[model samples]
Target: MGKVTGFMEFERLKEASEAPESRVKHYKEFVVTLTDSEAKIQGARCMDCGIPFCNNGCPVNNIIPDFNDLVYRQDWQNALETLHSTNNFPEFTGRICPAPCEAACTLGINEDPVGIKSIEHAIIDKGWANGWVVPKPAAQKTGKKVAVVGSGPAGLAAAQQLARVGHDVTVFEKNDRIGGLLRYGIPDFKMEKTHIDRRVEQMQAEGVTFKAGVFVGEKLVEGGITNLAKESISPKELMAQFDAVVLTGGSEVPRDLPVPGRQLKGVHFAMDFLPLQNRVNAGDKLKDQILATKKNVLVIGGGDTGSDCVGTSNRHGAKQVVQIELMPQPPEHENKPLVWPYWPMKMRTSSSHEEGVERDWAVTTKEFIDDGKGNVRAAKCAKVEWVKDEATGQMKMQEVAGSEFEIPADLVLFAMGFTNPAKSILDAFGVEKDNRGNAKATTDGEGCYRTNVDKVFAAGDMRRGQSLVVWAIREGRQAAREVDQYLMGATVLPR
Candidate 1:
C-alpha cells in the first residue's frame, strides 16, 4: 500500500546466490542479502488486497503487508518490531522456511509474488547489525519455574516467551549445544550456527537457563537418530522440581526402508549422517565420521532432508549424487487458480539440488546389494507407475515390468522423514499418544496443551508430528501461553 501502482511496475527479484561450484567447497551460508534499495523495491510490490491471505498462509501468521509497507517507507525499526512481534527468530525462518506466504500472495495469481522472505531477511539482518535486537528481561519475577524439554525452535520460542513474562524458564537439551535440530539437522551451508548462538546469549541475558547435554526422561528409542546424551534426568525429578514441564521435543523417529540388506553398514538414517558432519563443522573430533567422499551416494526420499544430503555429500566430494522419490513427479508449475491461497503441490527445487544432483521420481528401492563385507555396494530400484482405481478412485503405485535396475552406491542415506516422536521418552513420562503416536494434547479450550499427567504439556512435533520450523515456533509460543495461564490462573502472553 506504500506504492499503489508499485506491483505493476516491479517484478519479483530474488536474492542473489553464490555459484554452486564455489559454494560447495565449504559449509557456510551463501545467500547474498538484498541491498536496502532492492529490499525497498521488493517491499513496495505489496498490493492492498482486501484480504491478506499471506498472513494466514504463514504458519506464524506474520503481518506481511505491514512489514512490507514499513520497509517500503524506510521504517526499518518498526519493520523489525513487527517481525519480532510474531516471530522470535525471523533470521532462521528467513533462511530456511519455504515461503508459503509468497505462494498465497494475491499478486502471485497473475504475476510473481512479492519478495516477502527477502525483505524479512533484510529486516532481521539489519536489526542484528544495528543492535536493535536485545534481551527483554521481566521487571518482576513470578517465582514460578518452567522447564522446556528440547531446545529446538519450538522450545526456544516457548522459553523466550515465558522468560519475558516473568517466569523462571530452564531449557533442557540432550545435545551439548542449545539448539536441538537446528544445531545438528540443518547444515551450516544453509544457515550458520552463529545465529542460534547469538539467540542463546540473548536468552541467557533474559534469565533463561539452558541445561545442555542433559536428556530428560529415558533414552531415545532410535539410536543414532540424535547425539547421545551424556547426562540423564528422570521425568519424576523434572516434574517434582519444576512447577510446570513443557515437552517441545521434536519428532525423531525416522521412517526406515525395511528392504533386504537394510542391515548393511553403509546404509544409514539421514539423521545419523547429518549430525556427525555438523559436529565436525563445529570443531568436534569424532573417532568415526560418515563420509561421502569419492563414493557414489544415493539419497532416498525427495524432500528438504534429501536435498540437504545432496548438499552435504557434494561438500564431502562425493563421486556422484542421486536422489530418488517414491511418488510420481508433481507438475513443475501449479495451476494457481485451483490452489491459490494454499500451499500447492508443485515440484520444488532447493539450492542443494542446484549444486548437482541426479533426481528421479516415481522410483522405489527394492534392495540394497551387499559388498560381501556387511556394507552396501549398490541399490536395486524399479520404475513405478501410479494409476487411479476405478472402484475407489484412489491412486496406487505398481512397479513396471522389466524396469528393475541397480545403481552403484557405496553410501545410502534415508531421508524419508520422521514417523513420530521417539517412543521411549513418551513412555517413560506415561504420556498418552494419539493414533499417529504423537503426544495427545488439545490445542484449545480447557486442558489445552495439558497432557494426561498434571502440570505436563506437549507442543511442536511432539504434539503435531513432523512439521516446518515456523509451525514449531507457533506451537511453542501458544503452548507457553497456555502453560502461563495454567500456572498463574491468567496470562498476558499472546497466543
Candidate 2:
C-alpha cells in the first residue's frame, strides 16, 4: 500500500546468516538483521491484498499490512506498536516462527512473499533499542488473584494480560528459570535468554509475580526434562490460594521409539540432551553433560526439534550427523495453484540442516545397536515406500525389501516430537483431557477455556497440543479474557 509498484520493483531479500562453519563454533544468534533502508524496502513490498490472508495465516493474527505500511512510511514507533498489538513476544516469533504468514501472502501465489518476519524482527529490535518497550502497569488493582502454571509463551502471555487487567497474577515454573521450553528446549544459538529476562523484568513491573523452581504438581518423571523445584504445591493448595488457575504447562512427554535396544545408554530422548546444553549455556555446572564430540550422531524425526539436534550436534563438534524422517520427502517447491493462501507442504531445510547433516527421508529405525557395555553403537534402519491403500484411501508405509541398512551412531537422539503434556499435572488438577491427552478446553462459546473443574482454565500447548509459539500466545491471550470475564462477570481484554 505504501508503494503501488513496490512489489514488482523489489525482490525478496532474506536476512543474512553467519556461515555454518563459523557459526557452529559458538552458541549465539547468527541471523543478521536488515538495515533501516533494507527493511523499508521490504515493507514497501507488501501489497494491499483485499483479504489480507497474512493476518489469518499468522497464528496470532498479526496486523502485517499495517506494520508494513508503517515501516515503509518510516513510522518505526507505530510499526512496533502495531506488531505488539497482536504478538506479546515478536522477538521470539520473529526469530523462530516458520512464517506461515508469508506462505499465505498474496504475492507468494506467483512471486516471493514480502519479508514480514524480518520486518517484525527489525521493528521489535528497534523498539527495545529506543526504550519503547516498557511496563504498562494496571491503572488500579482488581483485588483478585490468578495462578498461571508454566512460564512458557502461553503462561507468560496470560499472566501479563491478567496482571495488566489489575489482577494479581503469579506464574509458577518447575524449572529454576522462568522460560519453559524457550529457556531449555531451544538452543541459545537461535535466541538468547536475555529476551526472556527483559520481558520478565517488564512483567514484574506490570504486577505479575514469577515463582521459579516451584512445581505445582507431582515431580516430573522424564529423565532429561529440567525440574529445579525445591517445593511442590498440590492443585488443592493452588485452588485454595488463588481465585483461578490457568494450566499452561507445555507438552513435555516426548514420543519414544520403542524399538530393540532402546534402553541403550547413549540412546536418549531429545529433551534429555537439549536441556543439558541449555543448562551449560546458563553456566550451570553439570557432571554429566551429554556431548556429541567425536561421536556419530543420529537424530530421528524431521521436525524443528530434530533440526535443533542437528545444530546442537554440529556445535558439539560431532563426528557426523544424520537426520532421518519417517515420511517421504516433500517437493522442493509447492504448487502455488493447489496450495495458495495456506501453509504448503514442501521441503524445508533449516539453518542446522545447511550447516552439515546427512538427511534421509521415508526411513524407519528398526533397532538401536548396543555395544556390550550398554551404549548405542549403531542404528539399523530401512527405507520404506508410502503406498495409498485403495480400501481406506490412507497412505501406508511399507519397508522396501532388501533396503535394510546400518549407520554408525554412538549417540542417538529421538526428536520425534511430544505426544502430550505430563499427565501428572493434568491429573493433579483433575482436568479433563481430550482423546489426544491434551487438556480438554473449548476455544469458543460460553465455557471457552474453562476446564471441567471449577475455577480452572487451560491454554497453549497444554490445551491444544504442541504448536507454534504464536499459537500459544494467542491461546494465552484468549484464555486470559475468559478467565477475567469469569472473575469480574465481564472482561474488556482483547482476544
Task: After superposing candidate 2 on the true structure, give the runs of residues whose Cα lies further than 4 Å from its correct spot.
Answer: 218-224
lDDT of 1 by residue, 154-258 (tens): 999999999999999999998888899999999999999999999999999999999987888754323353856778889989988999999999888899999
lDDT for each candidate structure: 0.94, 0.93
Backbone clash numbers for all candidates listed: 0, 0
Candidate 2 global TM-score:
0.99
lDDT of 2 by residue, 130-242 (tens): 99999999999999999999999999999999999999999999899999999998899999999999999999999999999888885543333577777788888999999
Model 1 CA deviation exceeding 4 Å by range: 218-225
Q: Any idea what lDDT model 2 has? A: 0.93
